[model samples]
Target: MRPNARFTDVQPIGLDAVAAAAGTDPDVLRLENLDTDVPPPPAAVAATTQALASGEGNSWLPLTGLPVLCEAVAGELRSRTGLDYDPSRQVVITSGGTSAVMPVLLATTEPGETVALTDPTYAGLLQRVRLSGARPHFLPLRVEGGHWRLDRDALTQVTTAAALLLMSPSMPSGVLLDRDDWAAVAETCARTGAYLIYDAAMERLVYDGHPRINPCQVEGLAERTITIGSVSKEYRMIGWRIGWIAGPVDLMDRIRMAVIYNTTVSSGFAQLGAAAALTDPSGSGVDEAAAEYQRRHDTVIDQLAGLPVVRAAGGWSCLVNATALGLTAPELSSRLLRYGRVAATPMTAWGGTIAPDYVRLVYSREPVERLSDLRYRFDTALTSG
Candidate 1:
């Protein structure tokens, strides 16, 4: 028997290749993974240890989530979005932010229905749409005045879509949609009856006074929006693999069924760690990490002057336009790895035909001091040709 035809056109080139290429090189600076070098908060670790020691986390938890974890997610959402959700019905934990996408798509959209996503989106999201058997349509974003702007005309096409997936502080570009754009998105989703899936994995990482806009705050959009967030980015707990999806109770009921069928439930111990992260009274760990990321963002922008790189307002990555280097993204990536000993993700991995001219550099993985060395190496590598 053969596999589903939906897997045919879904070839993904990811950062694993870059990591493998940079293997065992002491001088090689890894700028490929968006993972932070920061340690997980002490409290989070303690919480996980406690859960494991108590033996309570050994068995399966409620498919929705442990009550403490679910309550923590709802509380965090209320604090951020000024909206309250019932923990018992409105939130369900998943294996990770990435894992949450597939079930959401499966629960919301039927096979052959279209799911609209921004061009040059996260490659994993694109794969998820394909896995869900939904047609992937793109709403092209244009670089205008050194920022990524959503094309209004292209957005109109979203009206026919079964769902619209959006990532704030978008991957590769690091562009956060402004309030007006959020308003437009809300209007479109409300008018068209399309579900708005907001990927908020990096929501707390904004920089330079750029405010994070929650579409759920936009009046009619709350009921239709599903927010997927994780402790991976801000809490430095990527390996814990705990995330939550928050939305209307009815829709979340369907998502819970999907979760039950998929992984049964996320790690019970990991959920305890995530709960501690969200309820951290000091709030120093996440805040300090976000500040450090902002500093790295500024440092990279400053070091890469005169390059056609887009400025990152938030998130761990920004796109460098490699067209002037007279090489495709993959070719430039190879040269950088060979000569500069720097590993970066090529834009080819981001999917879509419009991304060939760029490479994604992640600032979060390296120390701020290492960024200067990365800059010098990149400069030497590009100019040597």
Candidate 2:
């Protein structure tokens, strides 16, 4: 049976794939979305509701995006990142962070041009890069005490003439890139003339009292940097299908072309909701959610950190080295699902070099009180096997 080439080699994402490989309970307790357990701001919801009630919610938006949302986005960027982005010229609202990546790829790279991404990165990023028909050069991240390290030499070598896709407070590992790492990456990209694509999806999810460092904040990199951000993680609006991109004007124009040609327009009313989110994030319904996630981070990391089997990394999750217990991550994940009623992602999904032996446990969506039970389950699964 020949599978369609487009998806032949891609790993299946269904539940059956979990059962077939792990021989554990197929039903997974999903906590991977990192979605806020809170609702959107009343102002945003009310605005959207009003738009819906008015019966004008069904309309195509502009290719360059809604002017109101774009201006709001510019204001937010100026406030948050201190970058003066012309919303009209530099911002394009898309379906989500997922949609934002493709257009950037379309705008920047020619076919066969390489994309350099960090290893143990966000899994979906690899798929997007591949979908764009570009080669992904994975730069392996060195895990130090509670953080992930970038190999500057490896980064420089791979980044020569390659587009760089970097995620801050990266997925799974949750290791936030510090100032020095950002500097090296910026310098490397500048030297190589590569486009720096910063995925700040989980930028706001940084824990342990770490300050948020926008990679675009680095000097001289803003002109060449393409920033993709989402309201999903920060504003509790994943269902809104509203995300945005900010970059150099010329590149942004090209991305708008790609967006218009493909999806045409995202929901007009949803853009309004997202605009509201951008304008008043602290006042948005996410402050409580961020507080909750912060609590979960503290609870999970403190519990898992003392365990010899796991090392706590900053972000929304903890990365456990499963090989230390003589079992692969998939095997342990399967067993945990069945016996412990838990589920975790195998790190290989993110191109981690030692993925088979490591699992990423997302803590954000889980209730803080249940973290104790999760820790116990993990202990049983890892030690028993």
**What would the TM-scores of all predictions be?**
0.96, 0.90
Query: Model 1 Cα RMSD, Å?
Result: 1.5
lDDT of each: 0.84, 0.72
Cα lDDT of model 2 by residue, 1-385, tens digit: 7755545334433224543443433344444445545566777787777777886546775765789888988887887688889888898888888788888888888766888887767767766777777777878776666556777778767635558898877776676787888888888887888989988777776666778888878876778888888877777787888888898988888888988886778888888878877787466855566567778777766767655333333456667777775677777667766666676666656664644457777766567766766677767766664
Best by TM-score: 1
> Candidate 1 lDDT, tens digit per residue, 1-385?
7787888767666688888888977788888877778888898999999999997676685876899999999999998899999999999999999889988999899999988888778888887898789988887878888767778788866658888899988887787888888888888887788899999998878888788787787877888899999988878899999988999888888898998898888898999888998998988387688788888878888888887777877888888888766788988888888888889888774657666678888988888898877678887778765
Give me the displacement of residue 318 in model 1, in angstroms: 0.6
Check candidate 1 and list the clashing pairs: none
Off by over 4 Å in 2: 1-9, 12-29, 285-287, 306-314, 383-385
Q: What's the TM for model 2?
A: 0.90
